[model samples]
Target: MTKTRLFHSNANGLIEHDHNRDGIDRRGFLKCMAWAGTGALCLIEGGVLKSFALGTRNASQVQSHEVAGRLTFVQISDSHMGFNKPANPDVIGTLKAAVDKINALPQRPEFILHTGDISHLSSPDEFDTVDQILTATHTPIFFVPGEHDVLNDDGKTFRERYAKNSKGAGWYSFDKNGVHFIGLVNVMNLKAGGLGTLGNEQLEWLRDDVKHLPSSTPIVVFAHIPLWTIYPEWGWGTEDSAQALSYVKRFGSVTVLNGHIHQTMQKVEGNVTFHTAFSTAFVQPAPGKADGPGPMKVPGDQLRSLLGITDVNYVQGRHALALVDASLA
Candidate 1:
């Protein structure tokens, strides 16, 4: 097994984490992660969240409990379907591998969450190719766009196709087996390497949407960029997320899921659990790992091993939501 490398990010930069052989430290810092290209399964029980790694190297410990809950779902992001760079030439093949992993799960996910970057250049053909491949999962999927996905026409075509039910800029919310899920769009108005923002309209909508929910409701907020500040210099965090997060502050359990950094990250603040899923397309540099955040190259033999898919579960009686991450390798 490849030795797993765990990294922790603070306001300064990324640093290594001390961990046991299995590479898990549930008692460590609130901000932590096993490097990109790994996955996790998440389930919610009694308004709390818990997560376990599903790295292929540790399959023996996770295969059976992956979907152990009332609701099971998976999150796969940043497919970048038309990209052909050396960072990952066969983005298609690796994405297929992600689906294969989901199919092999003991219990299939009820649905899938795609955090965005579905296409490299926002071309119809690119979206078409991505759609063709994803249809194989045989599961429903919900999406919020990334900067790469909203190019050309300001996402008009993208919305018409995937988010007709969504209001302005494709933001919406839904409920599943008791959990309240909010899909947010913060990639709009993006400047080059600039922070993500949720304008006043969306913010108002968010505030109104959850104002009536009970404090015990489990809330899952998914978006394309990190709602919390991960690395401001690299535009890894959101600009108005503070306002967005305030809406759910009363909730007993809040789980925020996102992509766009193309890596895995997690943090706990008060009652909220914020997590970012790894990309299926290509890997990106860690905070300050390179001159800036973009694609990072890995040898072809090691690429598939690094691509990951996240599984999320919501368990009714346990008082927590559990998440496990698994890699295609």
Candidate 2:
């Protein structure tokens, strides 16, 4: 395995780059894109947030002991399994690489959380390929539908295969390790500029769902598009997320995970931390960095490094959770 450079956000609101054997000079790269492609490992415990790197330790050791005794899960987004373009011709191959990365982890994640875009086209074959490949991890999986996943049939197939237990539009919630996990579907009705929308029905369900939970419960909300405003011109945000977020604001710790942009970006608001994971299929330009959002073909040598996975851990009784991002390279 190649040494991975980890980028994290510190208390001072600055991103700290941990240099490693890769010698990629991340500071210079971050300067070029304003820190756009950097990934993060977020630790939120006791209502406080802290950041750390995956460091130069042995991969297995880092995986096994990074966040012992905490609730740990893996977040992978935008697999786009059927995509076959110059940006990435072997989507299945890369997806397998992601599975391999997870399987090699010393500590198996309790479950794999796939934010969205499991397929480029909502075809049976596409979904099947994704399902077959992901099974190798031997871990239960959770999903939220991305715009691409609902393209033709309004997510009819996606919901049938991956979200039967979910409610209208496949939105659902469950409890795990004392944490509340909510999977939301926002790609059903897109607003102007392609922004995501969580209809009133889903919003109401969300309100009632968390109404009974104690304020101390940690909430992990996953969706296809970002719940916060992130370059609305590009349709990177949700139109009614404010209403949804309003429901969880009283909670002490809320972590919102999303995928769609194909790169990593994070924001911290009062009690909410919004994070976007990278795509395993291909990379997309930074917000407004290109004319529009789509597959971006980078130098072949750099593709794997630009694509990666996010590992998240929450230590019991600790006031923080730890997240580590590792590249396929």
Candidate 3:
């Protein structure tokens, strides 16, 4: 098997390729492991994907920082279901582990926000597989488009499958527990190594969308692409993101969540907090660490240890939110 690394992205997760020395790549082969702690293990075998989980815990054990009874939800980014690579043959199995991790949370999220790229190739089977696994959870799933999900038929399938009640081509807003949630689409027109864009039409709608809300309202904005600068040379940042952020600047509490980079990173600017999630799929080289960002093929034994998820808790009046990134490693 030969090990070749390919890098891909979607709304809330990053997809990278891992190759075996024999010159072959399996889309999804996985395994489960335990080392006396609460973490899951994923691996590949015979070019087939397999996985298992350990130390399942209750989600409620995690505390809530809500000061004024703030509404809370879980954000799950990129899960490239149909993906098969040398990294792990069982991409779906790992994704299931992620969902299991989420379902096992002590506090069930109000809903699940899937940043984008729910499937690997925009294929029916891939989407179906993701849906079947996520269905195990009782929470509702909201989604935005990632570049990979729209590659086929101009995202017709993606829009139909995930954008139920979403306004104007997958951009929409909702009110939950006195908080405002805005979902934007920026990966549709992405260029190779270029920033993600939010066209004039979407901008206009966004302005009108939040026009009636009071500035005191807390806001949560999610999309597949990062709203802030994160290695623009690799197309990790957004083009019209500034315009979008400008509209939300008046709000006292603004939390921006995105996926696409495949790693967990956080940045705070003024009252706005930006967070990116890790890929349940595989790992990637850090920014500028390699000639270009792609799936960083590591030794098979270390693969599961490097993957995990993020837990976010916030209180209404609190100035700082606490985010815990649990790496599979």
Task: Estimate the TM-score of every prediction.
Answer: 0.85, 0.85, 0.78
How do all the candidates rank in terms of lDDT, highest first? 2, 1, 3
Candidate 2, poorest ten consecutive residues by summed lDDT: 1-10
lDDT of 2 at 80: 96
Q: What overall lDDT goes with each candidate model?
A: 0.77, 0.77, 0.68
**Local accuracy of candidate 1 as per-residue lDDT tens digits, 139-252:** 999999988899989989889888999989999999998899999999998666669999999999999999999999999999999898888988888999999998998887
Q: Score candidate 3 by TM-score against the native.
A: 0.78
Every model: Cα RMSD to truth: 6.2, 6.9, 13.1
Candidate 2 residue-wise lDDT, 86-205, digit = tens: 999998989999999899765789999999999888888999999999999999999999988898988888889999999999999999999999999998876555678999999999
Candidate 3 lDDT over residue span 1-329, tens digit each? 12222222111111133454321123322111111123322222233222233233322222422212445567777787777888667777778777777776655667888998788788888888888988997789888988778886888888899996777678998887677889999987666556899888999999998888998888889998899888877878899899999999998778899888877665656667677777778777778888987777778776655555655555554443434445554
Backbone clashes counted, model 2: 7
